[model samples]
Target: MSLLPLSLACWNYDRTEALANGSVRPEGIDLNFQALEVEETFFRMLRHHEFDAAELSMSSYCVTLARDNPPFVAIPVFPSRLFRHSCIFVSAQSGIERPEDLVGKRIGVPEYQMTAPVWIRGILQDEYGVDPASVTYFTGGEEQPGREEKLKLDLPEKFRLEPISPDKTLSRMLADGEIDALHTARTPSTFYSEPDAVRRLFPDFVPVEKDYYTRTGIFPIMHVVALRREVYEANRWIARSLFKAFCEAQRRLYDELLITASLKTMLPWQIAAVEETVALLGEDWWPYGFSRNRAAIDTFLRYHHEQGLSSRRLQPEELFAEETFESFLI
Candidate 1:
């Protein structure tokens, strides 16, 4: 019998490594893992039938695909708090010290309408009374989805947006001194390229705004892994097996990459984040699956719509594979 050829699109090498090492072996499967930079890029390929399955973020962009595009099932994995964090930085020499100071200033980002930028702007408007409209934005040259063209759907129209070319991406501009501020939700991300940028802004610059966002019911940003609904529904075992493998990998990767015995000195939240991740995983062999996180996804999507981030709300099942929803019950 010919084995199933399944493609997984994810961010880091760990997912690829896990599958190759036989840690996440699915039934009737010959898996090929493709590491990608952006979830949107992965989804674009998914629409063209490039891969049998995929993992994408549950952002408005991804969810919109599940609704309007083909029959892809999206399973929500990981808490937004655990998955990602948004960062906004100014040149140390710019003297734009706080959120309020962002007014009339040019801000650079990869996506203008993404959750991270929206929340950042929302905070600026509500807490500091800054005008979000006045802040000129540069979206780091994202290509419009080809699916939009095929569907004859006006996806970008639902958003107040304009596109910038890849050459004008935020990182390149930050390096060229063309923009004054850089903001994003990715860690070990583009912003880290400017080593001395933070010290120039404040002799002592620490990430403070994220805590404020978390306290305000806006969870910290996180990236997710999405799948097609049909692939998931037809091959339910593959979803469960993949989730189990990821759970195992998350623990192994965390212990190896993040936790350091020598860094004995750390903040309380830093320690808490690590501890929480470990506690949640426990002795389980699979920590990476969405079967356990339905309520969290539901609550999160509701907030996205309520805050006007996504135009419509999605059911938890719509966000994940229905076959595996019962796994959370166990």
Candidate 2:
């Protein structure tokens, strides 16, 4: 039997690297996986539907669910989970000390509806009482000159979202104090090239994130695996098989990270980092499927809705293929 050939686009992270390399594949599929940066993959998938399936931004994905006919359907497999507290950078002169200080401030975002801004804004409102509506937002390309949301946002009335001029970029605005702070998944060019130029809102972001997790039990989810709706409808079985394959690939990658004989991946502290994470959180800290990630999923949906990105509040179960809700046991 010939296998179905499908193109997939996603970040080449440890969890998805094996699948991308063809070391692990779905049972009935031949995947042509492209290893690209998250922004590039997202741009291709959301803009052109370039691949049969790929990692998609949760905020953008939710925006499509309310459409008359959404072009994609997702499995419960989340390709990326990141804490967004560290994603914020503040101009040193802003005098912004904490999350609450962001009120009435001007903040630049790569895109207003991007997943990182969603997570950061949600956390800010829930934890520190900083309403997103209170802050003025400038949205545009993170480094380049012009970029727009793949899916249009239906933001609430009175929510101020300004478009940065094509001549200016978020990094330039942040560096020149045109914006008091910037919220983004990627660090601003100045933040990297000149450390002191901009500092993280929370210098001790790790501990603050740990505390936030301890209180809410929510590790923010960034991206999820989505299948094209036409392809998904024609091949429903791929949903289950691909979900299993992704899980297997992640397990294999995690095991590789624990290899102590020598460095298998990343740095010398690779093993220690895993141990510390397990000690701080749990062994299955990064989880797939709704069962284990209920809180995280529900929280994200709530944020997406409250942030005005979603037309209506979406239940976590509604965001995924129905068949993926309950897996089989043998």
Instruction: Give the distance in Å from residue 11's predicted Cα in candidate 1 to where it truly belongs.
Output: 3.6
lDDT of each: 0.53, 0.86
lDDT by residue (24-106, candidate 2, tens digit) is 99988998988888888888888888899999998888887888899889998888888988988998778888888899999
Task: Flag regions of model 1 displaced more than 4 Å.
Answer: 1-3, 36-47, 60-70, 79-86, 91-95, 113-134, 141-169, 172-178, 185-221, 251-309, 315-317, 326-329
Error of 1 at 234 (Å): 3.3
lDDT of 2: 0.86
Q: What is the lDDT of residue 217 in candidate 1?
A: 34
Question: Model 1 lDDT vs. the true structure?
Answer: 0.53
